[model samples]
Target: MALQFDATEYAARLDRLTARMRDDKLDALLLFAQESMYWLTGYDTFGYCFFQTLVVKVDGSMTLLTRSADLRQARHTSTIDDIVIWVDRVNADPTMDLKNMLSEMDLLGCRIGVEYDTHGMTGRVARLLDNQLTSFCQIIDASYLVGELRLVKSPAEIAHAERAAALADDALDAALPLIHAGGNEAAILAAMQGAVFAGGGDYPANEFIIGSGPDALLCRYKAGRRTLDAADQLTLEWAGVSAHYHAAMMRTVVIGEPSARHRELYAACFEAIKAIETVLRPGYTFGDVFETHARIMDERGLTRHRLNACGYSLGARFSPSWMEQQMFHTGNPQPILPDMTLFVHMIIMDSERNTAMTLGHTYLTTAEAPRALSRHPLDLIVK
Candidate 1:
């Protein structure tokens, strides 16, 4: 198998996961998240977008229930041995198939843990699943079981994160020359993504965010393209991906002469991110990080301009997002831990002044302080 990690690594991960399942009194786990499956058994497939699940029992035995389309996909990319295929046909209800499979494994009355909170578990599929299995077994919401275990990176995972960081820096370098006036957003975006591919990196789990002028204030990626003006702002949020692991970065570069408001917002972002760094270590909570950013931004009188969350955990993820369950948001109690990869961002968007300023980078948390993955400094870019 072309597993990203060695046999020993995969074995250790499986051991840790099942140990947690047993602690939670779970007889088996219905893993709907592709990240969860991939993390546990190297089951790589986009087929999770459909109805598919990896059934992991407390005994550490595994089975993948997917469509025939992903039969070869599972065999080729995963360590999973017991693969069961559900036929795909019109008016077919795969939930019935799942019910029968659960009975065969003697899990009908067992306490089964299901990952209900993920992109892999759509509302339709979840509803059908509950209808079919709720009365048959004891169902528990164990959405964060595998995600919690995956938070602290091993040495091998950290190495992939470091390589991804290098790719992000290369991407930034490639886009710098094309960020000036008259530059095309398409060309700039192409150059940035091209750099990652050339550096042997995979496409990010999410689209690279690119916007200029008034659109710079937007955080989410939207369709539409335009040219950079002589005096405008361009916001770029992108991630470097290696073997599905991510190290994300964000920045808003000045095009020409900066406005007083632009400088003020940048100053606020700089102060907020720097303040966050002090609390990004083991002693702080995810909530503490957000509080730190919130206080700094509010103290600067930029409260309305700042986002609710400062940043989130980064790791091996599939399409739609690279963010993990842990996040730097208000009231979040997840403690900062060593060997965790986190992204710290301070985005100040001022609609009144039509200004935007963002500064962020990925870091690997340690005992003393967090180490920045990117070699680039958080300097205010202007071209």
Candidate 2:
């Protein structure tokens, strides 16, 4: 049989989301974000303007409202049978259709849980609704409630992640050969992207971070006119998403020969990552991982200058709070559980050598242990 997404799995996820809303005494959940839309329904469309609105009823039934132009795709992609299309004329509010649809569906007066952050439900939208729907209904923030459900992974989710990680291995296999002296970063990225496309990846969660030598220290540098030098360390932190499942991989490379100090530094970071992974399993807090890394690095006299979080959950799709919230790094005590997928990244910048090194890989948590998906050897390659 041809591979297909499980509608039942999507239904189960909706049930979980609804149960959370019910436990909180919320009548319905208003899912209006890309990740939630894709999570609730399988509908994936590329447009930042046409907000995909979903009012998940307490009974587990949902009504998805979107632009009329996208109606067909929504119906085709979503598991939900009920869909609403809104197409209003000039000089008229577009959300009028939404109001009418909710009213017709008897959802106007319900105690709704709003995904305010994702929907961009501005104060104006709330005020308009306050004057309109608030006569019968109440709206409260439901993002956190819904987010709690997606924080873990399921078996099917792990399979998708495995596929994505395998694709990353393939992309690296294709791009590794391009890391020669004077090799342009842009060309290497193109080669890696081509490999991802060839391996059936739609696109990467983010652009491939292909940095060489000094540029690698910046972590998020753009592909510029710089070319790889024989003495420089070529670092890559890239991944591709398959069926909305994402996997990340980070590797460091050296063209020709690397100095003994460079090799020793890379080995320290490598050992640090391995030491963390050695004891990684269920029931450990994020704080434990942080402390473990600190202890390991202290032993080696290495500094963690990349502002990297120990790790975070990964699966299904890239959520709002990704891999420990890079911009605002906060530690979570949520114990790692079985079936949860995560990425533990060790990006170390050696100030003395003016070079940075990265060792990142995705893992699937099991009852017994964590499993690595990428088969690429962890040793530093001297191309």
The best candidate in terms of TM-score: 1
Candidate 2 has a TM-score of 0.87
Q: Per-residue error at 158 for model 1, in Å?
A: 0.4
State every prediction's TM-score relative to the real structure: 0.99, 0.87
Q: lDDT, candidate 1, residue 147?
A: 93
Off by over 4 Å in 2: 1-4, 88-100, 119-136, 221-225, 298-304, 318-330
Which tens-of-lDDT digit does each residue in 285-374 have in candidate 2? 666666676666667777545444655566554432223221112355667667766777777787776867678788787776788888
Flag regions of model 1 displaced more than 4 Å. Answer: none
Per-residue lDDT for 107 in model 2?
A: 75
Q: For each candidate, C-alpha RMSD in Å?
A: 0.7, 3.4
Q: Tens digits of per-residue lDDT for model 1 on 127-205?
A: 9999998899999999998999999999999999999999999999999999989999999999999999999999899
